[model samples]
Target: MLSALLVTGLAACATQATAPAVPGDTALGPVLVDAKRMTLYTFDRDNAMPGKSVCNGPCATNWPPLVANAGDMAKGDWTIITRDDGSKQWAYKGKPLYGWVKDTKPGETTGDGFLNGAWHVAKP
Candidate 1:
């Protein structure tokens, strides 16, 4: 368990490189986008637990988290957060990032203002 704790500590503090994702043009302006240019989003509920993602299970199914690869690290305004499942997800300025399944095309902000305005496009 000590090693696990150490790894967790490191993951929380270590930061490196540009994020795996990039900014893409959306009607919402420049929002964080995946390689496919699918618009990313942030959930207000996630604000409850700073740096943690609350959208899991079915919630995650609808809003897929912007998952970080094994070697991924936090950098600049981008920070790597540990999800409940122990998986790494990317967060910008402390808010977790996600993709909307409802968005079938790139630059789509259909997920914005979703869920009673709880969701909004992840901005740069």
Candidate 2:
């Protein structure tokens, strides 16, 4: 009986561990963060109509998009977007999400309102 209970507890813990982190709001406002709590951003140059990402090549190298895995799901305002390279990325409210390379710490908003207002933090 104890062994069975231990197995059950381990299964539960494993399930929770594999669950993807969801976008949440912080003191800066509603923003998407990774498991490490790093802030996510969006680019204004990217179009919202076709549900595609325009930040590629060098742009993508500087501002990495929040990649989505095969197991990730779309819920509420969160959705997945397929980049031109055919990789899945996370998007919020139809905008492709990204992580600025300049942001070194959690809750850092240095990328917010960047590039003459072309970039802004992803808000819920």
Error of 1 at 71 (Å): 0.9
- What does the lDDT read for residue 72 in candidate 2? 66
Q: Residues 1-124, candidate 1: write the lDDT tens digits.
A: 9999999877655533556678899877898898788999999999988989999999999999999988776778888899889989988899999999999999789999998999999888
Q: Using Cα atoms with residue i matched to residue i, what is each candidate's TM-score against the true structure?
A: 0.84, 0.76
**Which window of 10 residues has the lowest lDDT sum in candidate 2?**
15-24
How far residue 36's Cα lies from its native spot in candidate 1, in Å, is 1.0
Off by over 4 Å in 2: 1-27
lDDT of 1 at 9: 75
Give each model's whole-structure lDDT: 0.88, 0.80
